[model samples]
Target: MKIREHLSLLAVLCSMAMVVLDAGMLNVALPTLSNALAVGPADIIWSVSAYQMALLVGLLPSAQLAERFGHRRMFVAGLMIYLAASVLCSVSPNLLALLVGRVFQGLGGAVIMALGIAILRVVLGPDRLGKAIGWNALVVALSSAAAPALAAAILAAGSWQWLFLAKLPIGIVALAASIGFPPSNSTRSSIDGVAIVIHAASAVLILFAFERLNSQPAMATVALVGVAGLARWMIAREKMRQVPLWPVDLLANRPLRTAVYASVACFTAQSAGLVALPLLLQLGLGTSVIDTAIVMMFWPVAVAVTAPIAGRLSERADPSILCSIGGMLLGAGLLIACFSPASAGLSPYVAAAVVSGAGFGLFQVPNNRTMFLSAPPDRAAAAGGMQGSARLSGQTFGTLLVGLLLGYYPTTDAVSLAVGLGGLSALVASMVSFSNLPRFVQRHHA
Candidate 1:
């Protein structure tokens, strides 16, 4: 890669890191924001939900839009929006303002997330794609794991507003680096207004249903039904169109669809473990926040160390086999964590974290390579969108699953149960991954 390409990669990584960091950091700062903004806990949840909903709804559309316009233009526009929204969030005096700002931030983030992979596909040749994706995964894992600690440090130094303020410098640097990239040639396509409405409605309704499941079960059920109906309509509508916004044809590929399902399962397990372990450590075992953070640090650190190697290995090995091995390791780690006694020290927990992280890191890059490679070059943006959506949906499902388990087993060790379920999900993912091996091997042989 040339210096310019390296700088462009850096810019993309910076933008990706900022978004991931923001997602994780806000969770840590929610309590502080609630108190500072004089909002009730329930209402404060919207601050996060609004952002997530916007991102989910915008992802596919943004990808299509990127194709219609240009990746470089969309990326720069996204950065500008994100930077502006960050400043708005920092200066907001009330909850509503912050929520609105977060929504815009999420819209910007959707563009960045959707196009980052597509841009990489364009810039990097096929041989180097897996390695680049592996490095990208490393950045995501590292940013997510480091965010809480970074947020804490920032809060200790100043106000919560500084958290948003900190994003400005990174955004500026990313924008500058991104400006040198050549523009993508725009494709001519008529925008599908009805399809856009259907897609957005389905995404928002489904996400809202998930968000309300534990709180307002009745409303959630209704929303779920509405989502199902909208999704059916959307699919039927898209099936008739030659150039559908949803790209149903790409998903029709058996191997790609299987890879997507496996990705979701893996992320679901990972997210459940992440959410449950903190609760187990802090509330159940009476570990301090700092101590919990310290122990948890091992997971992302391990992922960062493992992913690049896994990426390189994918070039020479069957990704499906690698995914299976990684899933098994993740399952084993989660199973070990489930057996964590309340009186036990942190070493056991740390070991489990490291194992799980390493497994996830190994699984991610190869799986992504499989998904990206499966799609036709013309549908790269759609593939990227689908990949991003699968991750976010799986994470949302996992988080909610933990909450549901906790609620259902109020008298039991909910944390252990959730972790156990996560292990089961990982095992299922492993099986699915293994099932893909024959097809992968056949492809290679052919």
Candidate 2:
């Protein structure tokens, strides 16, 4: 039984790594893809944008479907879809075909992301849940850290097609292993097709607006207006239904809501810092590209090292307290980076990176555990979907914030200011995290 559990966990982690690695790998291969497909840079970007938009839009629907069917069935099906789509992407002769494949791939990725944690919760149960989630966080960190290097290596060895082709074997292995897992016996529920469509359309429009806001203001404004109307309609429709697709009941829980908000703020802060740090290193500090990359490696490495420890600690510690500490550390790290003297050199910057990375790693596992455990077991899939949505939303907002700041200021100091804003965001997240503690204690005592 233990061995079987381990195998299942391995399959889950591999699927997760494949999706994350592909997202990062494509960014590095975009230029190569453009030249090979004889497409403009603008056209090539849709390969990425299409994937992201589809993933964001499909998350909730996928979760609902998982609940209606079964998590294992959905997970295996998603892997199959992703694997097949990768083959399609690899063999595509033109930009349009690749774009189509990417959309399918994104849909598959969405299922995996939305249901992976929920599946983990079921497999590991509450006692070991934190550790499993911590390991999952490590997979994410490692995939992100390895992506650029892996992409460069693949391109160096063969054509860009190899990038997609490489994932085929990994996906196959994961799919095969996952087949041995038992099926979920979740009760099937009726889904509102109209509600699903409205929710998906609203999510897509909102994300699209964020993506286009800096480049095409008019289009973004139109998208924003569409999103608002769609959202209003969805909310109204959901209120009328006993079982809404959006998991409104879960969001109503105070602790869960706080965790979600804190998650968004933390990711927003992390994303903003990630964007600003490279600029500070390369443009402001006069660091070379290679040197900057090497130095920046410190952060993810710290995260990789810290996540497991935090996970173990979470088994005994109050996750809220850990999260609060993490938020403060993250904020402190960013502020330190913000105030680093012009001549302070790489050490200070590296220190800040490690601190912030560790903080994020610590915060993530506990926060995710809170998210998963807070919901009823039956709504695990919904909770997972909400978690993914919150993360993507936070990242999108953070990226947009950085873009706006740089566009408006267009100065060296702008990076510092943006990072400082990120720090403030983390501090706010800390406050939110801390606020959950008293409630948690009261509930425990009761």
Candidate 3:
């Protein structure tokens, strides 16, 4: 790549890393922050959920706003909000203040995430998109993989406030680097106020319902009923608009929709396996918390190894076959891990983890490439938004599923069952991905 392109990609990755790091770093700091703020663990958990809810609800709408205002304008504005929110979180004297900062921070992160890949596409151009996306995925994986260790170091050196304070420099660097993108020529189009409300409401409701499923079944049922009613109205409202906030038009394309299905299934399996593995490792293998964490690190590190190669290879290979094979590999790896003998050391599990992570790396880049490139250039922001939402929704569902299973089946090895279910999800992804094979063949010629 050219020097300019390298710098541009660096800027985009920095923006992504900035948002990702916030969540990752906060995970380890939760107990420390909880004690310091004098809040119960359950209440402190809201600090994380607040950001998640805001991000989930704001992603699509933020993309719509970015399209109207301009990506650069939205990006710079997001940085300011994120940085300001970080300071708020750092000095918060209580849980209420911290939750407020987290909410705004998530909104800002949503704006950044919603446009990061779109900006990367503009920076690198389509011919190199596959490889660039691979790099982006690798960066995200590595950032997540490193978070626990980094958060531990930070907490030992300072306090929980420094975790939020640490975001300032990254945000500033990203802001300076990203200001050079050409301004959007999009006119001051009147965004759909009603549609944005419906979309955001549906997202928040869905997330809330999923989180409540294991804890409060009655509340979750009510939320689902509300979501169903709202979704029906949203479909009717979005279909008539030329540029719908829901992007039902883009989703109508068979290739893109199939790709989305595959993406969602793959991520559901990914999250479920990750969540269940820790418990299974400690119980089945008798590994310590620290040892289990060390073993789990192989997954993302393996992803870092294969994601870029998948990106580079997608340029020449048919992504359908690559993605399908990746899916099968992932499922097979998970199943292998499940059947691994308790007497066998961590080596078998570690190898399985590597295989599963590498498989995910191979799947994600090409899958995301297909999803993004299938849309018209004007729909890039929406496509990316849908892509992000799909992954997030799947993750939430996977975690919820495991939580409910554990609660309902006390004394059972729910972790192994969850891992088995994760395998099933991966197989589903493979089938869905292969179902889109004809499109790949036809698109290559077109």
lDDT score for residue 85 of model 1: 95
Residue-level lDDT of model 2, residues 169-274, one tens digit each, is 7888898788556676756588779888888788778877887887899999999999888777787777776667887888889878989999999999999999
lDDT (10s digit) by residue, model 3, range 1-446 = 66657666777788888788888899889999989999999999999899989989888897788778877788778878988999999999999999999999998888888887887787777889999889998989999998888899999998888999876888788777765665765756669998888888888888888878877989999999999999999999888888888889999988789889999999999988998988899987789999999889999999999999999998888888889988998898788888888888898889889999999999999999888888887778888888988888788878876887798774237888888889889989999999988876787789
- Model 3 CA lDDT for position 277: 86
TM-score of each: 0.97, 0.97, 0.97
Clashing pairs in 2: none
Q: For model 1, what is the C-alpha lDDT against the true structure?
A: 0.88
TM-score of 2: 0.97
Steric clashes per prediction: 0, 0, 0
Where's the lowest-lDDT run of ten residues in candidate 2? 179-188
lDDT of each: 0.88, 0.89, 0.86
Better of 1 and 2 by lDDT: 2
List, residue by residue over 32-83, the lDDT tens digit for candidate 1.
Answer: 9999999888989898999999999888888888878888888889889999
Query: Where in model 2 is the C-alpha error above 4 Å?
Result: 444-446
> Which ranges in model 3 have alpha carbons more than 4 Å from their true place?
1-4, 442-446
Query: Model 1 residue 96 lDDT?
Result: 88
